[model samples]
Target: MTQFIVSLAVFLALHSIPAIPAIRQRFIRVLGRRPYLVLYSLASLAALAWVFHAAFQLDYVELWPPSAWQAWFPLTLSPVAFFLLISGLFSANPVSVTFRRGDMKPGAVVSITRHPVLWGFLLWAAGHIVANGDLRSLMLFGCFALFALFGMVMAERRNWSNPLNASTSIIPFAAIAQGRARFGIDPAMILALALTVALSAWLLLGGHAALFGTDPLAMTST
Candidate 1:
């Protein structure tokens, strides 16, 4: 537990550095943009590796026994979660802290929510924590949920000039309805959606069992 807590702290601290503009700017100036990015990625990966190691080695303590109905939660929500994950990857919104300028218009998925990746992580974490209902699972997934939510808040604070800033709500389509943003559909978004659906199918079939030693479909049957 101590090691796990330390790993989580290290990971969060490393991630939070980029949220501090002055420190980030100084680091970028000193290290140069490319080198700074490489160093940051490496450090974050190392911290994540530590977190994974600690999590896998930790003994489980049952916090709440898994409810039969809880098993259906991930099965139902994972498609939306994975869609958000993939769509966010393809979105070109400048407001997103993870924004990568792409050919696609910064709408559609961006119109749904500017922070799709974080929202994806938040959903994934919430679903798993509810299904697993154990101390170790709670600690692992709960940390991710908190991290995702915090990252969204920090990113919004850092990019106050975001076009959608006029609307304070993070709910899907809220900005669009308020005329703060608009939706556009294109080939890239189509590709992202198709891929998300395929990936979701693969996970639901046998991938979940192969990776996590449990079949979501079988769980649903019980």
Candidate 2:
């Protein structure tokens, strides 16, 4: 538990560095933008690996056994979560391709939420917390949920100075209703969405157990 907590702290701390503009900028300046990004990515992966190692080593300490129906929660939500993730991958937002292509217009995904990836992570984490009902799972998933929620807030604040992004929102379809963003889906995005659904199905069926040592489907059977 001590190692788990420490690993979690290290992961969160590494993530928090980007939220601090001065420190992030200083690192960028000192290391150069590309090198800084590379190093940060490597460090983040290391911290994430430590977190997973610690988490998987801990025995299941149940907080409350999930109700039978709770087993379906994550299963049902996984497709939607994957959709958001896939859409976010293709969305023209500050984080992905738009970072390089400054002139790119917001797409269907961004029309729903400026932070689609974060929303995806939020849903994935929240759904797991609802389904697992274990102390270790709660702590692991809850951290991700909070990180996604707070990261969205931070992202919005970071882009606040841009007039075009000013009216964009974190809430789904809010920006579209406000006339700040529009939805346009191309064939490529549609294909990506289909692939994401297939991947989600694969994960829910057996990939999750193979990777995490827990079968969500077995929970339903019991």
Which residue ranges in model 2 land beyond 4 Å of their true spot?
13-47, 95-103, 177-180
Candidate 1 residue pairs in backbone clash: none
Q: Itemize residue pairs with steric clashes in candidate 2.
A: none
The 0-to-1 C-alpha lDDT of every candidate, in the order given, reads 0.75, 0.75
Regions of candidate 1 where Cα sits further than 4 Å from its true position: 6-53, 102-107, 167-169, 177-180
* Tens-digit per-residue lDDT, 63-175, candidate 2: 88767788788888777777876677555555322211234665566667767767877888898998988888898989989988888777766777766565566787787
RMSD of each: 3.8, 3.8
Could you give candidate 1's per-residue lDDT for residues 1-222 as a string of tens digits? 899999999988886765455667688779886788789878978998798779878997998866679987777767777777767755665666332443345646777777777788788889988888888889988998998898888787878786556643477678778887767676557877898788878877888777667888777666
lDDT score for residue 138 of model 1: 90
| For model 2, the run of ten residues with the poorest summed lDDT | 94-103
Candidate 2: lDDT of 98? 23
**How far is 67's C-alpha from truth in model 1 (Å)?**
2.1
TM-score of each: 0.76, 0.76
